[model samples]
Target: MIGFFVITLGPMLYSLYLSFTDFSMLAAPEWVGFDNYIKLFTNDPKYLDAVRVTLVYVLVSVPLQLAFALAVAMVLNRGLRGLSLYRSVYYLPSLIGASVAVAVLWRQMFGSNGLINQILDWFGIEGMSWIGNPETALGTLVILNVWTFGSPMVIFLAALRQVPQYLYEAAAVDGISRWGSFRHITLPMLSPIVLFNLILQMIGAFQAFTPAFVVSGGTGGPVNSTLFYTLYLYQRGFTGFQMGYASAMAWILFVVIALVTAVNFWFSKYWVHYDD
Candidate 1:
């Protein structure tokens, strides 16, 4: 209890108070009430841009990541030879995908005249700088997020294992087609796991900062195409020294995530299943 208060609750309360003030780290915080929030919504175009970019990143990446994870998990559940080795090899990306080193490598690979362009050259196809163009910069980040699907893949694999074999056998006996069996048996059984992975991946995608920061060189550049909400908050707080405004952004993000999570739970009854 003491640790929670000290580590979580205390800082949160302090930040909430700071959100209404004007703190620049070098000077004492001045009480400003709702000014920070009002500016954020009504006056700050860049903040609105960040919100749009972040929403695009989250909406596009999370569903693709979860779908890819489920597909890989289903493939691995087929009892392939050296399953453990394959699982470990596939899982490695999730462990390092968010690292600075990986982000640097990704930037290089997506840059003009880099490996991706070279590959395109081999096929006599033109390739532009994926990480440079405003149109495609966010897409590269989405692919990166999708590449880090190992964690949810492992979870889906476990859930697939727990599904009753007899249900599949019954479907087979009833002459169900492969797709039908998957739809009626596999999907229903995996719905709960799907919901679980969706919530987690959605939240993580919203909080993502490293890839955009490193890929865009901390500017969220190319006309702010990759300006994630967190990245903008960091710029305000740490770079621009607008800590109070940053605090307001942080609280807004917290509320948005909470609302999104609540909506997911509220809608889960329509599809998510349980043993009960």
Candidate 2:
């Protein structure tokens, strides 16, 4: 509790106070009321662009990542040989995907003459500089996020094991098609896990930074297309020395994440099933 207060709650409360000031990190903080927050919304085009890119990143990556994870989990749950080894192999990416080395490797792979283009060349198809183009830069980051689906895949595998086999057997006995059984039995039973993974992935996606930071060379370019909110916050706080403004951004992000998570819980009542 002392550690939490010193590290987490203390810094949070300090930053909350700092958000209402004008601190350049070189001088004392001067109170500014709501000017920083208001300026971000009303005067800052780049801030709006960051918000737009982040929302797109969250919406697009979370669902796709969860779906891909669930599919892989279902496949691996089908009594595969060397199950433990396979699980570890699949789970490795999630462990390293956010690391600086992995992000650097990703940038190289998506470069103009990188492995991806080499593969396209083998197919007689031309490939552009994926990370260099604003249009496709963010999509590459989304793909990177999806590639780290191993964590959720592991969660889903555990949940799938807990689902009683008798349910599937009974569905088969009732002459239900495989798809129908999956839709009726598997889905309803897995709804709670789905919600859990959805919320987890959504929060993670919202906080994604390393990939964009490395791939875009900390600029969130080629045109601010990949300017994630966190990256912008880092720029403001560290790179540009606008700590107070960055604090405002951080608080806004905190509120946004809380609201989103609350909405997910509120909506879960309609679709997330529980045995109780």
Candidate 3:
């Protein structure tokens, strides 16, 4: 309890105080009374752009990632041979996918002379540099995010296994189609896990930083296409020495995530189900 208060609570409270003050790390923080947040919401175009980019990323990546995870989970639940081997193979990416070194490798793979474009060359088609173009830079990051679906995939696999086989047998006897069984039986049963993965991935997407930071070479570059919210906060606090403003941004992100999570929990009563 003492350690938690000193390590977590203390720094958090200090950071909150700093958010309302002017602190550049070199000098003592001078109280400014909401100036940082005012600048962030009223005067910062880059901050606004970061918010937009982060929102798009969370909304797009979370759903697509969950969909991919669920689809793959359904397949793995079908009792394929070498199930353990395949699960480990698929989970490998999620284990190291978020690392800075992996982000650098991803950048290289999408570069002009990289593997993807080289494959395109085989079909008599030219490919543009993925990370260089503003239009596609964020898209590349989204694909990277989706590629790390192994975590939720594992959760989905566990949830899939918990589903009683007798329910599926009943469906098979009823003349239910494969899609119908999934829609009526599998999905309703899996909705709780789906909501779990959705909430986890949504929070992760909003806090995502490394892929964009490393891929954009710490500049959020190519016209700021991949300027994620956390990356922007890092640029402000550590790089730009605007710690107070960055703290305000962090708190704002916290509030947004908290509200979204609350809304999800509130709405889950309508969809998410668990057996009594």
Candidate 4:
């Protein structure tokens, strides 16, 4: 416990200290009080852009990913043949989804001469630069995020199984159609699980790094369209050696995530129902 405290709390304290200073890797840090935070809020356009991009990415990707996962989970819960095999096949992507190899493959697939454009060409559509255009680059990342919904799908499958069989039978006896049974019975029971997945996916989306980093060739290019908050922080701290500013950005992100999680928890009380 002492070691855990030291390991976790020590770095957090160090980062707090760093956030108040002007530190580069080469020079000793000079205490600048609230200058970093002030600059971040007042003068930094890039920081604002990062915030917008992060929020959009999280809001758009997480819900879409969860929705797709729930849909797939419902399909998988139907007692299909080769259930285990199908689950394994769907889950394989999530296992390797964030790896460098997969990111590279994504880059190639979204490139101008990539498979996507090739298919579009077969339909007589002109090939557009998917990753080279600022408007569509972030959208591509959102699609990549949706494609890795397998992990949440598996979780939803487990939750779906735990739903009481008697509820369905009761609904059927009352002349409820299959859709009505699902809407009235399955949905209410699944609400808590959906909330759980939403929080996890939202947090994960905020921290998304590898796909954007690799897809943009480490440039956050196409006019910074894919410059996620974490990627921007990485460029500042590691690439530019602006440790103090980066630490400030990191703390801001921590606060934002905390606030969002707290809000979710507060909202859950009204909607998330547990059987017991």
Q: Best candidate, lDDT-wise?
A: 1
Model 3 per-residue lDDT tens digits across residues 1-276:
999999999998888898998889888888999899989989999988999999999999889999999999999999999999989988988999899888999999999989999999999999999999999999999999899989999999999999999998999999999999999999999999999999998998999999999999989888888999999999999988878888888889989999999999999999988877
TM-score of 1: 0.99
Q: What's the candidate order when arranged by decreasing TM-score?
A: 1, 2, 3, 4
- Model 2 misplaced stretches (Cα beyond 4 Å): none
In order of appearance, the predictions have TM-scores of 0.99, 0.99, 0.98, 0.97
Q: For all candidates, what are the clash counts?
A: 0, 0, 0, 0
In candidate 1, how many clashes are counted? 0
Q: Could you give candidate 2's per-residue lDDT for residues 47-154 as a string of tens digits? A: 999999999999999999998999999999999999999999999999998999999999999999899999999999999999999899999999999999999999
> Which has the better TM-score: candidate 2, or candidate 4?
2
What lDDT does the true structure give each of the candidates? 0.96, 0.95, 0.92, 0.92
Measured by TM-score, how close is model 4 to the native structure?
A: 0.97
- lDDT of candidate model 3 versus the reference: 0.92
In terms of lDDT, which candidate is stronger, 1 or 3? Answer: 1
**lDDT score for candidate 1 against the true structure:** 0.96
- The global Cα lDDT (0 to 1) of model 2 is 0.95
